[model samples]
Target: MTILLYDLVGRDTARPFSPHCWKAAMALAHKGLDISTVPTRFLEVPTVEGGVSKLVPVIRDGEKVVADSFAIALYLDEAYPERPTLFSGDGGKAMARFIERWSQLTIHPYVTTAAIMDLHAMQDEANAAYFRQNREQRFGKRLEEVMAARDAGLGAFRASLEPLRSTLAYQPFIGGQSPLFADYIVFGALQWARIASPFRLLDDSDVVAQWFERCLDLHDGLGRKVAAAAAAAA
Candidate 1:
């Protein structure tokens, strides 16, 4: 059976390489699953219209539609049980689940904010225009309004980093020595934030920085894919 992933190739605002999606993609890649990506602009339209819901990183295996990143990860794990398991046996699986929840509820917002600020700083005019056009297309509102909403979202985003900072202090990976499903989810969001935007929040945090580097190393091939996408976008 073919695995189809709905993804965004590069810096498209509507279908940005969200961590949630990244987690599923990386997991599938790591498992050596037969996968193909179908690029989409905004998740909500394809999800709702296509019956996948507003959730990104939807994985379709034949007629089986797996929505939600975490759910998709679990499905992939069941489909392809292999070495380098995304989740350890029992306890590890529980921990992985917790990390996934934490990343979504806490870490993602701050990383996203930092990324946006970073992107704005590096390529303000171009990025702004890109964001405006994308937002207008997806949200159907004035660019200014979207920007204002983004600005307001920053406070919560900043707050999200604290849990990650604390979590990383103890473990190399989110779940422990080996990266589990949780790491992939968090990494995707962090990577998107760092890559699409310009923020280097990882710069100051030694543990988080090291962890991020490790994640890049783990999915070196996917990194190349992302680089190629960025180049193509450029």
Candidate 2:
């Protein structure tokens, strides 16, 4: 059966910009599962799954409803045990949880500031206002104010990527020979930036850059299918 994925989308429905959503999307692709994606906006999230879920990346497999990106990934892994594994083994599964947390707590903050403007510009008025209000409340400043110093945040962002860069310098993928769910966790964050903003998060020479490119080429150029919007153009 084709699973129903309520994916978070932007003004352009084709663009699914949520990092969490990307993790689930890529995980599904990795498992070679057939998915029917519904492009869902922020305001519409509450209506998903009969209003039981207030988040995107909610998936319905038959009568079973799963919410949260990570939960969905775990569900996919268990639901399709015969397919390719999202986590290689128990250790990888536990490690993936740590990596996911680090990406969310450490990396997302920097990305938020850098891509805030580009994200807002791409949104319609309602989404733009909703995003601005929530984000501003969290950051205690305006969206423009947060993104205005993106250049200033570049150093920190690059520094935040050091662990990934160092690791990729020696290995082809985070899981050594192949990308596991852990790899998708990190890739999703970068993909989030790519879809929402043109701000270059990695330097041209960084190994992380090369790793990210390899990730983009995965699953028949699925990542390349989305057009990246330039942050300056907004």
Total colliding residue pairs, candidate 1: 8
Candidate 1 lands at a TM-score of 0.71
The C-alpha lDDT values of all candidates are 0.64, 0.87
Candidate 2's residue-wise lDDT over 24-87, tens digit each?
8999999998999999888889899899777778999999999987888889889899999999
Candidate 1 C-alpha lDDT tens digits along 1-234: 668887654444433466667888888877777787776554233543366566577878887888888788778777777646777676767777877777766766455334543443333355456655764677566644444546556555655566776877777877677778777877886777755654345444456667777887785557434531232233
Candidate 2 residues lying further than 4 Å off, grouped into runs, are: 231-234
Please give the TM-score that candidate 2 achieves against the real structure. Answer: 0.96
- Superposition error at 182 for model 2 (Å): 0.8
Query: Best by TM-score, which number?
Result: 2
**Model 1 spans with C-alpha error above 4 angstroms:** 9-16, 47-49, 115-171, 228-234
